[model samples]
Target chain A: MVSVVPSLWGYAIAGYVMTAGAIGLYVVALHARARRARDRAAAIAGRRRTSTPP
Target chain B: MVSSLERVAGRITAPRGERILGWATLVAMAASAVMSLVVSPPDAQQGNAARLLYIHVPSAWLAYLSFAVVFVASIAYLATRRTRWDRLAAASAEVGVLFTALAIALGSLWGKPVWGTWWTWDPRITTTTILLLIYVGYLAVRRLSDSPARRARWAAVVGVVGFLDVPVSYLSVTWWRGLHQGTTIRLLGESTIAPIMQVALMTGVFAFTLLFLYLVTVRLRLGRLEDRAVAEALSPRLGQSAEALLEQEASARG
Candidate 1:
């Protein structure tokens, strides 16, 4: 008679996947936010430059 | 000494330095994944389910580290009223919340198999949940005041007070009966884990720490840029161009 033990690999895999996925999403969001802020600052500066008299 | 320290900080926070840190974090994370998933052996008792320990422990540890930084930064902000201290506290708290949530989620995943339940009102779990809520409230408090100084002051106070939960959460398992296990990696005494497992766990912690540093640096840079944009937008002059304003500001600093 063979004793059967349940395979527990799925839980481990799920945990790792969730950790990586959440961190990856956060990194992407941070990059997007930084890009938006940088662009806003640059655009404001450019507008000011073009509108002002030399 | 202060000038030298500032110079060191300037180099580390520079764009090039940030890029270097990012690449290094990527490499460290890759190595950690391999160590965690491939190199480490399965537990004799818990079997493959123990693998979750790698990520779970590191996420939890990083959460603790992040909040500790917030606690110190908040105190500094209250004492000195420095904007940079407030920025550091806010950045650290945001990252701490992310790791705290991740830790709880991963803990649930691990517990489902080992403890035979997905959710429980275990002492540790309860305290940790409350810890998360406190920081969430701290983040929410940042938006309450319109004045930046007022917001920072309020947030700093919350940051300092909310950190009291961290210790309670950590000690909950020992303080009361619970389904959760006690500390595995003991600082003073011998650890219960095997040598190979310890190596894998340490690798995970190192990689996660690097990732935490990288994220906070980027967040701090974003905070600076956002503040500058707001300041520029609010203080526009009729004749002066933004470039002229920037140049004048730079010369003034010089």
Candidate 2:
């Protein structure tokens, strides 16, 4: 029985790295966009409250 | 454990446990990486190149799952005119495209090493490419319209029509001879994959699914916030609150 030696490790590593990196970047982008949107919503709400006299 | 999880879920605000899900997804993805790259053995034929399967297969699964969510959500959106459903469809479409693109890239990477080419116009590959293009067009149609209701309607229609590609892509390998292989895991019976490879691949699927859920949730919340902000901006009344503007918009549309 012949053993199958590992080959194309570079391609495997590159593929995995690209997958992980892409996912990571997307996650980060989501968080950043969420935060910015939250701030904008708060600002909108705050401006409305300030303009409306109690 | 169930009770604790429920309590945590109840405590989280709109988008519900965004932090918890995000962290869980990260942990699951890390575990999957370890299992796939370190614990799994080389393939009998493809050697180390087979490791790409762990990521590629899972991504393809997620792409399908995400589009399925889009399809269901789009139908719900069209039927109900509810913002939540529209947001769900939009977020799912975005994430679905991302995963689909990743699957194509990983498949290309695997093909380059094993098939001695970066790409081929295989039936499965061509169908999957069409799938990606369809969703991208869905996203573009979403951006083309300014009115929320109009945009949602158009995108929903696209989502429903675009979903026809999913089954086509999935069955392409078997329906026609292609460079890609047929399904290894099936619903009716046991899988044909090696035990060790099966474990890693399943882990990848689980992790990628978690990540997809987290991403879509976050994207939905962002969409909601943006919608609210835009509503406020569009309101006729000076300094109108988002809630008030939303009411005004709804009434105007009605």
- Interface quality of candidate 1 as DockQ: 0.74
CAPRI-style docking class of model 2 based on DockQ: medium
Model 2 C-alpha lDDT per residue in residues B79-143, reported as the tens digit of each score: 76766677889999999999999999999999997888999999999999999999999999999
DockQ of every candidate: 0.74, 0.67
Best by DockQ: 1
Candidate 2 backbone clash number: 0
Q: Candidate 2's residue-wise lDDT over A1-54, tens digit each?
A: 766665879999999889879988998898898888888877977887788778
All candidates: CA RMSD (Å): 4.2, 3.7
Residue pairs whose backbone atoms clash in candidate 2: none
Best by lDDT: 1
Worst 10 residues of 2 chain B by lDDT: B6-15
Restricted to chain B, the TM-score per model reads: 0.91, 0.90
TM-score of 1: 0.91
lDDT, candidates in the order shown: 0.86, 0.86
